[model samples]
Target chain A: MKTIESRSNPLYKQLFKWQSSAGRRDEPILLEGVHLCEAFLALGRQPQYALFDQTRITEPHLAGLIENLSEEVCCLLPAGLLANLSNVDTGQGVLFVVRPAVATLPTHLNANMLWLDRVQDPGNVGTLLRTAAAAGITRVLASTGTASLWSPKVLRSGQGVHFGMHLHEHIDLLAVARTLVVPLIVTTLSEANDLFEVELPVQAAWVFGHEGQGVSQSLIDLAALRIRIDHAQAVDSLNVTAAAAICLFEQRRQHR
Target chain B: MKTIESRSNPLYKQLFKWQSSAGRRDEPILLEGVHLCEAFLALGRQPQYALFDQTRITEPHLAGLIENLSEEVCCLLPAGLLANLSNVDTGQGVLFVVRPAVATLPTHLNANMLWLDRVQDPGNVGTLLRTAAAAGITRVLASTGTASLWSPKVLRSGQGVHFGMHLHEHIDLLAVARTLVVPLIVTTLSEANDLFEVELPVQAAWVFGHEGQGVSQSLIDLAALRIRIDHAQAVDSLNVTAAAAICLFEQRRQHR
Candidate 1:
């Protein structure tokens, strides 16, 4: 395998771009650690290229992974250089340059879908995606202000669910709301139906809003159902991800 | 108000110590940002001391908080000095040194409680605490290997729910399980009843395990109920916090 020792190497500079949020767009993003790499490979897709830290090549898991990849698409880098591109504290000693499958918004948003209205935190966004996928929902849309779905932090928090999901970002949610045929369920803080007591539609578009602010007024005006998860008054509200899990799973529990 | 201009100031050093996980034990931990400070004050608790960045002290929220505090216990510091002790990216120009209420284990572990088994990530542990509190489960126990409950990261992610929870850390689970009067609900991967189909107990101790490992074999053996959340199977499992929310809220729904 070829070794890249210098920081100034062209390939190293190209890989470095994949580490930033801006770099994540359009370009193939870097997938770190064994879990994500394994997830990507499990989807019957191949990485454009793979990099392994020379120091960890002998490790059993890393070695087994390397043995599977063709020699041309694999390379070795010194530990320091590899660590520089790693977003996590402990570098996993491996990264795959792979392009995520581009997804298109469906004409009818009728499935049990999730619409994120500017969910800001990367972890929250990622966790919502994972929760949605686990609930067997295949489609998700995010407004412009939401965290980028493919950012490294979101990817790590997502824990490999991104592969199985069909995600659309920078969405015009208002426009979509106008034409939507399914029940539009928006979570509100007050004066709404209780999530548990409400008659949930079999398939609907669920909207979760910004962390600090609840769903925007325009969306609330358009909501076919405005529901709230009733909790003790001691705490103001549940975390967005936690709320999503409860709401989605409750819907699942009812239909099951 | 007193002004602290030097990094060599003893008070600054003491505040700096509270920034680390090791410093959180048996000491007044620092509470950052307006939300957390407001949450603490809402509990009708006074800060041992409060610090504000000199540059942003005139801002309305900071000024308002300062107005309510006794001048003797509040101090002003340069923005740089204040930022040094901050754990979050954007410093809110304020910090409160408050003592968390000490909690003792009650003889009866009979409440609808959550037992965290070696949950490692501070974010996960904090989210779990926040979720548990929102679900109206006031008591939570964390095993020894779990993240430090009072660490700065956990406290930040917890979003002031720490003030409402009766948390006991460094717990011996097996011993607690033996004497536990209520049903012990443990989540497992296989050969268990489905969470949705199972008849959940009205009052039980819910056990959520480490991120990678399910509940320990010993604990699983002792479980009164072994349950697993049925998902699409495209992903491995629900996040620990997500699972806790679903289980706790489901119990709430059953009895509601």
Candidate 2:
């Protein structure tokens, strides 16, 4: 029921700051739109605050979402203010600021996971997470050069899968590779086994790298297997997200 | 070299118009960055005009690219002018205006093809085209509701694959589906065969629909088979581009 009209308000300034760049590690991430908020609520995770556009709050869908939230967490913002806080051109009229659940990496990795080495595009990083989650991979590790896992663009691209998975960012991937109990599968451009021809391991860490500069030599040297997705020779390489989907699902098919 | 420093100039105005929206059917499409330009040249196609930033034209890479073109086709623009014509934040200092090669739809469709039904996102549409090309689907048809395939953002995301593919826009997909010789495979959310378990046709028309909406009922009714990619129940569905990659590559794998 609280209405914040001034840009100078402490809460509004904090929201604005969090929307721009990677905030402090512990800061609650900004989740935009009804779908993401619904996803968060489905996980039984409560938002620190739920901000809605005052004019559009009476719309049936937005009102339905409001009824599910605790009255204490709801706040009203003018349409302009709400739009300004949104990353997309058309504001979705609702936003959730939720602190993600903290996760710790296991000492000895035995499960199938994803290692993103400098996957700079936020959309690519987020889609990879979504694909990894759908394919039943529960943990994902990203090097420092990777896009911020909690960035707004990524959260939008990731849809709601971030809730059900363990995400470790700014990781020392090479060090982790050295300590892994499972095979490390690296995808490369050439001189690698065709993905369809190889016998994939049941549980391994799949390493996908930067868009232009692929898997680093250190990780390549440590890979238990190197695979490439064979395509018509016209394309230089598959988009990272596409490659991830094909590889992850192919693994699923093999195990099935 | 001719210098274009004024925004009011006719040539500059024409380039500006082409950059903003879908131009006339016969208008030349804009190709940005060195990679795209190189791709265009590799096809043995020359741009109607190559515009470069005056100051950056002397850079080694740009200069080398310049050597391949006839001096009559080149023009220089002030940095500010050239940057204004770019879509990305950092302009690559080059842009090409070239009329795309005309393509006609075959009356009796037998080859593997892609039918995009109201796939509105430029990035998604473009990425789909690139994926189709890489998977060896030579022909792509898009309904009117789909994003303009020749738009700048689609061209950028498509990389250079547009040059090699036969792209038909503003299509009546239902009409085409009715006359198809090969099977029409529709991707659906539920009540469909699992993609991996099904016997995929070697030559089929794969229909990927809008982002939020699955394939239309009309298309679904005409489908020889409806297939869905099975994934974890936690997430709603795979991103369209990701879904296309999985489906296309799976077909390729089975055929091989």
Candidate 3:
């Protein structure tokens, strides 16, 4: 195993940038925890290098897993230093640095998709990604005000589903409207047809908006339809992620 | 405005206990932020007292709202001191201490309900409550291990919907199961009938478990039915709140 000590190790600086704001540099993404490392490899993606805390690999299971990684891609660091690489408490002791997967918009699209408009919370953004992937609606377009998709907080909450989808961030809603061949349906709580009452198009693009605001005005105006899921009348509306799931699952339900 | 200065003041101590953990005292439940205060009043509930930060309540709208809160219940504290009661970086500078509303279980119940089995994270617990209320689920029973239903974190995430639903926490699942007349359905990702393929009972009790563990074994065994929501095969499962929304809405969908 190769050792890298000191935060000034150019390598550590690079890792920090990649972990916090990989989108800024178009560089390798830093994935922490054994689960994510396994997910990355499971997707048949190779990492630039895998780091492990030599002192923390005492558990037979962890040791065996670390030993399996080829020496060429293995780098060892002190346990405390490695822990600093993770946001999680009692760190997972392993990390993988991989190139961000390229996301291409399908030239001829028919499948349902998800569009996020200015959704700021990283956990909500990431959880939406996981929900999108799980619902098999993989193509996601996020607007400029949305949280950066490649940030570590999003990745951790996303649980490695990044490899499963085509995510395009910093997208213009007008550009999407011009290119999309299917109905652009926006989910809102007010002045919309009940989701159950409306006939969902077999293939459409669904838009969910910011926590505080409904879909941005421009996008809502361009929407072919607006649908609202009926809940208890007293409460204002559903949480963004909850609304996303209900909408995505409704789409799935219709197709199924 | 009546003043409260010293942290050692007995009134401040009582307020702190109510804000952080009041379930033990069977006393007043605290509400924070201007939105929650408005909701509580809109529901026709009166708080024992409303507290505001002298310095932070500058916005005309906020000031007017606070002024309308009735002089009998108005209490003022210094800005920094009031901010200490909040978890957010910038406090909203308003809090209401309302007696916990008595929630009575329905006799000979026919409406669908949701149950929380030791779901511990305050955010998840709160979000679940919000989801349940929005989905027209009025009755919720939570296990003893679940986070206190009225904790500030849960209250904030609930976004004022806590008042719309009947939340009974620190409960014994076994006792509820014995008393429930509706079919109890436990959600699990493991072996079970696919949610899409199965016939969902329009009026039933749905159990969502802790984050790491799915539905507990005893609850699973006691359940009248076990259902699994189908997601993309690669991912483990959806977030519990997302899962709850899907399940509850599916029930609503079927009956609607």
iRMS per model in Å = 0.8, 0.8, 1.1
DockQ each candidate and list the results.
0.83, 0.82, 0.77
Candidate closer to the true structure by DockQ (higher is better), 1 or 3:
1
Please give each candidate's TM-score.
0.95, 0.96, 0.93
lDDT of 2 by residue, A33-96 (tens): 9998998898887789999999999898799889889998999999989888887788779998
After TM-score superposition, the amount by which residue A83's alpha carbon in candidate 1 deviates from its true location, in angstroms, is 2.4
User: What does candidate 3's lDDT look like per residue over B1-256, in tens digits?
Assistant: 6889979878888888766765553778777788888877877767898888877667775686675677878888988778777667876788788876677666565667778998988888888988888877888888889888887788888888877678777777877787778899999866788777778887888899998787899989888888888887758889888898888888888877
| Model 2 accuracy (lDDT, Cα) | 0.89
TM-score of 3: 0.93
Clashing pairs in 1: none
Off by over 4 Å in 3: A20-25, A106-109, B6-9, B17-29, B56-58, B102-111
Best by TM-score: 2
By summed lDDT, the worst window of 10 consecutive residues in model 3 chain B runs over: B17-26
True contacts kept of 3: 0.84
In model 2 chain A, the worst 10-residue window by lDDT is A19-28
Q: Mind giving the per-residue lDDT tens digits that candidate 2 earns over B4-79?
A: 9899999899889887754347778778899899988888878999999999988987997799888888999999
**Candidate 3 residue pairs that clash:** none
**Residues A84-110 of candidate 1: C-alpha lDDT, one tens digit per residue:** 888888978999888877898888777
Query: Candidates 2 and 3: which is better by DockQ?
Result: 2
Model 2: chain A TM-score against the true structure: 0.95
